[model samples]
Target chain A: MIRSKIPLRTLAVLASPALLLPVAAADDYRDYRAEAMAMVKRDFQAKGIAGLDRLEQDGVQAVCNRTGNHPPADVVRRLEQDQMASVRFPADGKLMGDWKEGEKLAQNGRGFTWTDKPGLPVGGNCYNCHQISPKEGSYGTVGPSLYLFGKKRGYGEDIQKYVYSKIYNAKAYNLCSEMPRFGYIGALQEQQIRHLVALLLDPESPVNQ
Target chain B: MRARFILAATAGIALAMPVLAQTGASADFQKFRDVMEEDNPAELFEARGEAYWKTPSGPKHASLEQCDLGLGPGVVAGAYVQMPRYFADVDKVMDAESRVVHCMVTLQGLTYEAVTRQPFSNQSGTPAHVNVVTYVAGQSRNMPIAVPQRHPKEREMYQIGKEIFNFRAGPYDFACATCHGTDGKRIRMQDLPNLTRPEGAIKAVQGWPGYRMTGGLMLTSQWRMNDCFRQQRFPEPKYLSDTVTAILTYQAVNAKGQIYRGPGIKR
Candidate 1:
């Protein structure tokens, strides 16, 4: 009877190890994201144009990641308000720039990639999402067609402000908006964004005609 | 002078012949129908999407089984092919993705910001909204398009979209028709579909809400139009704005009777 009881005790101890295995595995998965983030921090080297800071998440991105881009209404509104506040309008009060320059910027979806040099102007990459001009045959349709942006919206001050703000900080309106915040991060200058606004809102521009 | 003129004429013909021959060869090679027949990766997205639709999610801990997809609610099959349609509940015309958002908000009780805030990938995560869109768009594959323009609102949107499509501007003097108006045009090996024609419009419109091979992004139809405007050097379109819906309505209505085959894989 003593030998049999000893065997039972050993079995109980052995069973304990097996039970802990699942818990360990669960912990690993829970920490997987954290481990990955740490690994990226250690391994990723920010070179010339590309900075390590790019990996850093802002408040909006942090919330977006946590909630999977479906944050609660109150949270989204708060975050969007914060983003809106970050937008700095031009001191000169000029919102419209040359449409010709804007056209060039839109078509040129270059810059900001690792291969690009710092200080060079980044392309708006708008064509990557919109159908603006009628002439360009190759255009992506990630966003809506703004062919008659000015004509349909009416080129009023309210429209101008909306266009300016939209280009400046798309996230201000839609927190998880796919449209890049051209002016918010300084990827585009005020002048460049203004030109973009003009390209869309100027009545004399071909978009209206 | 006569001899020189003859020499020039002969040289021109010599240069033109090869160009014409190359053009002819490419025209023969441009049959995308053959490529589409074998297998479409969009089918894969659809399968994954189906799994997601039935999967339980959200803080509420429920599946989207009760979610409505514009066919009298809780009916997802063949709904995507006829999207950008009018919805009385929202008092507006909504597209596939937008309608999905509506369901997520109304049925799932997820906030609009949460649903629309991120790009599809980020929103989708392990069980993401991207997969849901893929699943929804897949349901309409091979179904003939039949946009409901019977509604006054729908008709109005189509007119607005047509005006937007034809509106030309910018330094390049471009309109949507500039690149897509003609029957045969291409930019660097990519064929430009003439959206005016039903076949071309169906092919073009149906393929969107697709996975872009180049950027490795799952793009929606709204994103497609926005990208076109960007290329045209115009300002970006607002997310889910009426303008974008109008354009979608125009394309869908024009593509009436054509089968839907989308949320396609694109290069």
Candidate 2:
């Protein structure tokens, strides 16, 4: 194993106090928004699976961007309601899928880079931001740990639906969440989302254990 | 029978060692970086870059020896740290790589398209431009970053860059801020730099044109920013776009006065 880099990095930063000047005030150049957007349009080239359309910020995204992910509470409430309306539940009314498959998807963080092939199954990438299964040592702390989610919340249909919708479009519950609208963005299929829900709420899953 | 059983156990332990090693891989990688720093492979690229700067082979048969890198014509020392500053000649602020590209085009009579055609080095080989940047960066080793905000355009680029850093978009809803806006956080185990801060911002400026050990390819910050947007699931920003310069400016300005160790190796 390599040695700790934090101390070395810290020492380097400590070696230069005179050079660490305060950042320029960000008060001005709010007017650059239009120009910046224009630059984004001009400078960014769509390649492979990532299209120019990806740059198009929807109303929700625009609000989030403009507010620094801190839109006024009222705006957040309304936007979150709108987001909730966009979550399409499976007509079959079944929410949970195989936990084993969901576990695999959580562990798999590969997909959606420009180099990735289209039409392939996308991973849920749950473990990248949340702790779900106790066995996972490398889970990120971006989102809350969902370990024992079903054990704590119960294995009811309502909770299952909540988990399903949350995975599909997280902004429905909380606007400006770092969590992606996985199903809304068409990154995860309804069944894939269902599997994720099971991974969180299935009593037999490692998450509950 | 005992000998056979002992051999099987030893083999099993050997097989399990890699898993144990993976647990401490980050620390191991840091140790590897420490050891490798003394005899970095980046110096080889720096030497080649120096040669490229002096060599004349493009359509005009001119060398980048006469190229002005904001400091003045043909002055390579400490130039990397003072850019993405505004260039009066080009009427735009340029980072080290873009300036190298400009010189390759303007001085050597190469087309922008041709020079940047395979701008980044790949498995096949290191690009001339990437090496050029390495050489330029090497000249600025141990020099302070002074990314200028003296010119109106330079100031404007810094402001625009700040916006881009915080601007959230794409399938992931990630801005550069999402991962890098905070400290003591990691996507997995890899620490994310708080790019908004001085200490954190320097990380972005340091060690590029880096010799990436994984592919053994030399890469510049242009590739770094482009790849960041790609990983953010956003469309690729064109090579040497103002959007990128703006972001680089913001980081550099934040990191102003910090010492750049020049071209270094990466994991």
Report per-candidate DockQ.
Answer: 0.01, 0.33
Candidate 2, residue A134: Cα displacement in angstroms equals: 2.8
Candidate 2 - chain A - TM? 0.83
| Local accuracy of candidate 2 as per-residue lDDT tens digits, A8-69 | 33233223442233455786525666677888888998899888877776666667776678
User: What is model 2's DockQ versus the real complex?
Assistant: 0.33
| Lowest lDDT 10-residue stretch of candidate 2 chain B | B20-29
Going through the candidates in the order shown, the clash numbers are 42, 6
TM-score of each: 0.51, 0.86
lDDT accuracy of residue B243 in candidate 2: 91
* Residue range B1-267, candidate 2, lDDT tens digits: 555455455545654686544335455555556556667899999999999899888999998999999889999998999999999887988988889999999999999999988978998888899888999999999999888788999988988888888888777778888888886556766656788888988988887878888888888999999899988988899989999998899999999888998887898
Name the top TM-score candidate: 2
**Compared with the true structure, what per-residue lDDT tens digits does model 1 show for residues A154-179?**
98878888899988878789876656
Q: Per-residue lDDT for A157 in model 2?
A: 98
lDDT of 1 at B166: 56
